[model samples]
Target: MQVELGQKIIDKIKADSLSPKPRWHFLVREWLVWMMGALALIVGAASVSVMRYLAENSSWAVQAPYGQTFAGWLLLSLPYFWLFLLGLFLWLFYYNLKHTKRGYRYPMIYVAGIALFGSILLGLAFYTLGVGSAIDGVLGRKAPLYAHVFNPHIDFWSAPEEGRLAGLVVAHVEGEDTFRLIDRKRGEWIVTYNPRDDIFVVVGQPLRAMGTISGEQSFEAVRIMRMRPGREYFQRFGPTVISVSGSGMHRNK
Candidate 1:
């Protein structure tokens, strides 16, 4: 019985070797999976780039009157839809990577780690290549609806009365609390600091002010802070400026 079984195995191997093999299908499938992973990585990287661009250009810091802690503003203005898309791509990459030839030999953690690491590395490359920016510009010009859907600055200046305004300090109004501010919307406004608060004002600085909008293009600042690009929102607020003087800086409020 053992000899017969051995003979059968040998016969089976010979038969398989002689048969017309469609094993090319396996190779094709493997390449297809790899392509899917590559595509996912590309898209994930693009989404990241667009998200960074939005954060850099966002005026959310200064547009809401109800004071937003950095954390609150981040929660409100984050490009969540793009982030969701990025997550979806990463998931697809993982799924595809897991199905490739010999992929099952690895543990799930290893599979996931490779996918994540590869995607991140590819993402950084895409960002440095400016692929994201190019894609963003194209989408904005060619697909208005799509661009609007993903646009990060849609509601940056939505409300004024709540002491939110984002803009560059163009000029200090001659040693006064008032400064000329060109807001994100290209609207100019007069911003006055509260007399009791001490803050340094700098020309050409990107800034956000929280206080009250008294009239058209006029704002009374409750708090002022320099705005930075690509910084994460934190729960803690920075120290408020106390005063600015040609003689020196003062922090006593």
Candidate 2:
């Protein structure tokens, strides 16, 4: 009876033309899974770092005058793009890890926990290396909408009509009180100020003006809050990450 059953199994295999897949095929598939999972984990780490960068650099102390509650500003200032990337990569990591050999043996909680821990660990390391600011700058330059959407510096200064205008100081005279500024809205203005206002204007500085519009393209700045000098915005976001517009400084005679 055993012989007959074995013969029947052999006959079924012959009839179906069944054959084993090459061992190398399985190896390649497993390798691919590992590669994808690793890449996903790396990207997730980057997202976390950028999130940290935004949280650290945002002007949380100044939102009160804008009538924005802490929760409201917090929501607006979030890096939505990075948040999306993190979620997408985390899912990818989990999916690829689950498909790996013996991976099914682990519980979902275990797999997710691994992803979370790895992101936190690598994210801190990347932040230490300044990857967060670098990536944010690149994205801000290449994708201008990146600033329009989630940049806290840009969002906070968007209320120009409310006497809040912010931009990079594109041009200024040596030892002079007047300077030319290009704001985030791509509006260039001639800014007149008083030196005794304790305001020092310099080229390539991100500045917030507390004044009212005086002309079609002019501003009479009462006092300017000058942030640490940074690279030009709109064209290129620098350490300050304030997006604005304008080019080539013209000496207004």
Candidate 3:
């Protein structure tokens, strides 16, 4: 009687084990693929919109205000986001091949291919913009310079009550190494050097400053474009002045 009871218990355990269990792995894999695909579609749409807006607006610089709109965000997020999706897809594909008997590897590969293609395209788009310049600056290929300069005459005591005062660097400040530009009418405006490209000027040969200005300051030239380093040529229409203030300078330690 005890032996029969033991056999009965074993049979029950086997039956329970043979009962179908939920395929949690398959469900998770499907969910991940769906989420990644949705993100890719959204980013793709945003990229198209930004590209169109930029094309229509000729004055829109890569560092312009509207540059960070939805389109810009999409371009910036695309590569990394898609690469993440690709990794997920690859993992799911491998898991399905190993554990599940389903022939879903091909579908996973297809999804990964789409993600890879999107990442490459978005990366290319980003590089075409000022991203390349930023990378160059990071690698020390280009020296950083203050984009805007303030006139030297304007004193902070009697600076403009409203509106921005900015100019190009006429000389470097002795102690601070700051660029000195004169807002001849207002006085002198001093802008400190910024390290990051985000708030700072774009990285290039001589560097350019593009930002807004407000408050009182001295500035002879409203804006100076692309002032070359160690050169004294002023008002030659060399580069277009971007803005009136050093508000665009960004510094990150």
Candidate 4:
């Protein structure tokens, strides 16, 4: 009885193998797999671009002049949409590849690893090409969420009475130790510098000044430094940092 059962199973397999398969079936499957891969790569790079954009524009660059912690910086990056999208695309990549021929031979972990690695490599290339900045510019102009989600909370930085102000320096006040500073919210402040510190103020530079709010739109800066981009962003949004309340400010005296 066992021998008969085995012979019957072998004969059925042979019969199935001899059946003609539709030529278009394989072609369609291959096409779908390729399409999914292409899409996965696109979204993967887009995710990286989002991170790069936020890193460039975050307030930490303006406030923290010195070094910052990596883990802290990573925590601040949560609100941005890219990190979520990256994970989503990676999963999609794994799903698409799994349906392809021979894909089942590899474990899910292997597939996911390959997807993540490919995405990261593609993402870096997109960031280097300024794809992230271009996307941000578009979103900033068209999407209100751009400001709502990614922008740093301003009430903390607007503490003019606490001797701190954040903004872009739009102009110099003649030969005086002052320049026009525009905060992320577009609020303008008069930033005065300590003459002895030799702090340089250039027009249109992003800056954070520490002192007191002298007027409705004025702030006095006792110290200043050229803002470095990525670190400042992490400082502003990082987890341990509840508010950007001059936590990174330095005194020149």
Candidate 5:
């Protein structure tokens, strides 16, 4: 009875002209699954790196002017769209990894934790290497809608009445502590400064200032920040990573 049953199964397979798939077919599928997982991890890392760039470049030390706590600033500064991308790619990474040949042995939570942790680790490395700022520069210049969406920096400094101002140095006297500027909206400003700020300015360079609106079309700067077209950005303590290669108004002292 057992012999007859086995023979019938073999006959069915032969009659249907079915043949076993080649070994490489399954191998390729396995490799593809692993590749997809790795790609997802890399992209998730990029997303995290960008988020860190925004946070570190934000007005983290200048919350006094905004009247908000550190927690409040953190909540508001987070990029929800980027956060969503991070979560989405994490899921992709987890899903692809779990489909691998030996992946089924691992618990779901283990895979997910690895995905999250790996992304964060790689993201930190990317941040330290200035990849985040470089990506930000590309997006800021290439993506037209990015300015409209990421307008916090511009909006915050536009409020000259609240002791904040930013614009390009349109004119200035050589060796003088004052300059003329035009804002993003093309409005003119007369800005007086101090040399101790360490931010040497020249015509056509955009700058940020905080102090008081001195008078009609005039302003006084208690502190000033310089923005240039490079990878070197200023931190409150000193020069650090990040830059106006895609940002403005990043220092507080």
Candidate 6:
């Protein structure tokens, strides 16, 4: 009888050891959170790279300065904003998964609270960054303009003749700063600088001008306007009529 009883006890122990254990919902939840965190990190890195590239290379030689300014605005507002949001979500997801598994059952009110708090922080940050400046420009509180300056450092074209004007300011506009120029025949043309008065170019400075027929001209009226430095002297709605080749200045109208 003793031998039989010892064998029964040993069998019970073996059965207990071999039996399948119940799944821990918390472990699964933690794994999912980790996956999400990895994804967010990858996306954030990609976003940073793209934003940097756009900020640096978005414009032609003359347009580079203005492009950089606009890129700064974008970096402050869009890319960072999205990155913060992603981080917030990742944090909340992790918190929920961790706390819930620890046998602490809390309502989702905590998560909602956290999200609200994060959004408020993001709003405050945006307000501090001069995003309001863009809004003000739209509201007409300030006139927004873009300026491009020629860079003598880079080679833009393959043709030797085209190289003469490579670093020269090609086309500039004040009222319409975002205008694009295209060659109808070759579809190749250089972008010139278009600086805003308040932002890039200063007042009382000679503005540079270059054209296909006209080599280049430096004039005094090129002084940046106190209020609208990038705007042309005439303040016309369309392209201004500045002297391209001759000593005389004439309006396109």
Off by over 4 Å in 2: 1-9, 12-18, 150-153, 192-202, 205-233, 236-253
Stronger candidate by lDDT (1 vs 2):
2
Per-residue lDDT for 1-253 in model 6, tens only? 9999999988998978765544766578766765664454434333333333223322344334333465553433243443564466545544544454442455566654544454445444544553333332232222332111111111122122332221122233444332122221222233333443324332222222222222222221221212222223112222333333223223454
lDDT of 3 by residue, 137-239 (tens): 3322222221121111112111233222323344442334245454324244554444333222232113233443433442222333342221121222123
Arrange candidates by TM-score, descending.
5, 2, 4, 1, 6, 3
Q: Output the worst ten-in-a-row residue range by lDDT, candidate 3.
A: 149-158
TM-score of every model versus the real structure: 0.55, 0.74, 0.25, 0.62, 0.77, 0.26
lDDT of 5 by residue, 167-239 (tens): 7666666566777777766777888989786455655556778889889989998888754321122111122
Q: How far is candidate 2 from the true structure (C-alpha RMSD, Å)?
A: 5.6
Residue 160 in candidate 3, Cα distance off native in Å: 18
**Top candidate by lDDT:** 2
TM-score-wise, the better of 3 and 6 is 6
In the range 147-214, model 4's lDDT, one tens digit per residue, is 44544333334456666565555555445766656565556566768875335565544555566767
Q: Provide the lDDT at 67 for model 5.
A: 80
lDDT of 2 by residue, 139-230 (tens): 66566566555455566665667777777777766556677777766678888888875355756666777777888778888877754212
**Whole-model Cα lDDT per candidate?**
0.65, 0.73, 0.38, 0.61, 0.72, 0.35
Whole-model lDDT, model 4: 0.61
Q: Which numbered prediction scores highest in TM-score against the true structure?
A: 5
Cα deviation of 165, candidate 4, in Å: 3.6
How should the candidates be ordered by lDDT, best one leading?
A: 2, 5, 1, 4, 3, 6
What does each candidate score in C-alpha RMSD?
Answer: 10.9, 5.6, 16.8, 10.5, 7.8, 16.0
